[model samples]
Target: MASVAEAYVFLTYLKVLFLTVTTYLTCTAHNSPTRPMFSVFTSYNDSLEKTHGLPTNLSWSQLASTVGEDKTSSSCQPVGIYSIQRHGSRYPEQRIITTYQTFFSRIARSRINEEFAYLKNEPLDRFTVEKAECLTDKGYNELLEISARYPARLFPLFRDPVSIFTQSSFQSTETNRTKESAEAFISGLCKECRFITPKHDEDKLILVMKDGKIYSEIHWLPILHDPLLLPKISSGICKDSIAIEEHSREFYSFKNSPFVEEVLHHVISRLDYTGDFSMTLDELQSLYEICATEMNLFGASNWCKLFSQSDLRAMEYLYDLQEYWYSSYGYRINYLPYCVLLQDIASHLESSVASGSTSTKKIFKFAHSTTIQGLFALLGLYRTSVIPTADNYPLDGNWEYRGGIISPYAANIVFSVFRCAGRSTLPNAIGDVKVLITHNEQPLKIGPCDSYYCDLTTLTSYLRSKVGSCDLDEICGGVVRDLPMKT
Candidate 1:
């Protein structure tokens, strides 16, 4: 009923307000490309409605043609390769909590809660969140669907009716996540999946040598429980948590402890080994001899001065101390106990795989975002030293609030699909196993691997800069791989 002049004036004022406020704020973080991510209802576009275009492959008939892959008109042949991949995007539902504890422990507890929220909503997904690694409920469904959609890309072991397959879980010996992820995966697999627990003491594959041996490995797994125990850090710690919890003890000490690695790090840090040069055995030993007295006199606080005197690799020593010093000392100071029985569970898994048939058994490891990034040297993913514990809750529900095109935290599921490839070596033909990442994201404003999922467009942009072009397929590395090529 309004006049045309009045309507134009009203629309003009609204447009002015939108441009000056909401639109500007919302669009600040977006990097819209020429094409939008998804398209809908394009069959009649070209003939009836002309402005927009459809994806090149869109057609009802072609879509139908591709539907029956798992249902072929032909007989199946044996192709028994197994490959591993992490789970797709998920988010640990974040929550605010309240508690008072040491920083690290507190962090662990809160992060568990965020993950707990995820499980609460998505209970059917397998994976328990207690320990260091495991999948979530959404991750459980996502992987099952991923395999179903891309069965051709999946290892042959996963698709076989006779094959025993399930995901590997990563649990830090905590509580909820481990049990939950395993349950989710088991429900989906509907087959008994073997569990591979990590060792209590894990050795880092720091370098692969010219002799083709995997060595120079510094361990990340040993300090907690039995000397040789390697708890499947993931494998979703069992529902019998109470059974192994006593074994899952952590140690602490205000006084200096006798862990030799702690002493060595202290002395080396004091001397400042940048890692440009190696230390002699006697020098290493003598330094350890002096470390106890020095640490006893000064707490973990001043232990670095010992390396202040070393000009050799001063920077490198500082770097090592920067990275490993706190952990080493924290381990010694805490005298934490590890879950030996839990570790046995991990070993049991390795043994199970060793004993299974090369052609028949398949192992799938489902674990956390950090477990994969930390181990793989993914220079891209972000991790924090602060573990989020239950105590981090703000008094108000409005803690750390943000809006207007905010990017969310994405959780990943990493799979290490293990297949028994040989008979004589205890299923030891290991080099053939593969790894891949699957994500449903574009680029992030913060950048690649910004969220748990690798931001493909950022990686693509980075690679394009290095290669002097933007064609993603032409080079070896982009921000993210477009499609995993089978080697």
Candidate 2:
């Protein structure tokens, strides 16, 4: 409670402070040679569309195509389709919801700037900590669309009057969002299919050896515990300690970097807290999470308006660094967990080739982002030579290992085996089997395949070579042995 004159003076000071920060941001962006250069700032709408590390639609960007698809003949028939999908977009975890509660409570009381005035009365109905991490309506709808698109994309490979009935397998993690996502995807794939309700007690799909006896067989639905997917988490290893150490090292490096410091300084100054207020790393992370989650929930977010595209990009880089070190290409041990999954894929394809009509046609696994990231690491999809370090704020060249592109909500990897009858580019010595791998429905030229259609032997050879004598028990400190797959 201040006098009118004093209030006027404070408002004037805030205006000038904002102007100063804006000018500084502009000058630094233009003058600094090391800073990441973007195209001229045209419109805020354009910036809104650029989801740096946020959840975006599956078709946000068209991945580069290296194979000559037009040159290849359509004589090949799709023998089997193996896919591993991340859960659809959902509410952030409880921690982030708690962040929303804390930050918004403060924001509700604070005098917000004109740009973000909406936050003063923003809807807090769904921001409670208890209500979090479930798939949204938009997420379910998007999964339906994704399922529709995949069938259309691979329609050429589908047997006439495409059907997944009786020949398909679906699996998901025990998590609610994953199970819901799987249901949504299957519904879209084939509306008439019936599934046994996923119950923890009876729907357990994984094979277990109880007193040296086989306890289960092939499951039509997802398993409750998939060691292949949740290797690091399920294994009784202190991998978290190692991840924490690496994350802290890189996080502090970026947190202390000049660009990040400057951005945060401006952010605090812009927030216009009455007294000497300092922003913590947790608060900064919370702001970004709010922006990202809100954007997915609603088409627009006021939280996003606070940062310039360059500022947001810098923030995005921080998260990219986090994901890169903790999940992908951080350490060899980090990706060894996925070796079992890779071997499973190889075995599935080989079995399909050996047993023609009796094999499963489609196999879908609904999992988490870590599963996708680990698989990417094992396959060497987007590994960059330039390690994402704190000092390298804006990675120089076209850096590909982005969290948004790689493991956004509903991120997926699909492998299709095509049996070619006529002349093909693949060597005849290894049979006429070709494999195509796609990430979010984009053809990927990675691993043993430089082209779109990789030979089965080449793909399997690379996987086997990479997984040579891999022992999960040894890696996870003899905690758990690799569960044998039922042949």
Candidate 2 per-residue lDDT, tens place, 228-268, comes to: 77777665552432446644577678867777766676667
Q: Write down the lDDT of every candidate, Cα atoms only.
A: 0.27, 0.63
lDDT of 1: 0.27
Q: In angstroms, how far off is 385's CA in candidate 2?
A: 1.6
Clashes of each: 94, 1
Q: Which candidate is the best by lDDT?
A: 2
Error of 2 at 173 (Å): 1.1
- Tens digit of lDDT per residue, candidate 1, span 1-487? 5699899999999976753452122111213221111011011111111222223232212222333322221222222322223333232222100011121232233323231223223222211223112333444554454334333333343454224232222222222342343334333443223323322333321322334321221222322321222222222221112122222122112011233234345443333323432333334332222221222122121112233222112222222222221222112110011122213222332333443333323333333332222222222222224321123322222222110001111223222222222222224433222111322111112234333212223333432333233222222222212333211
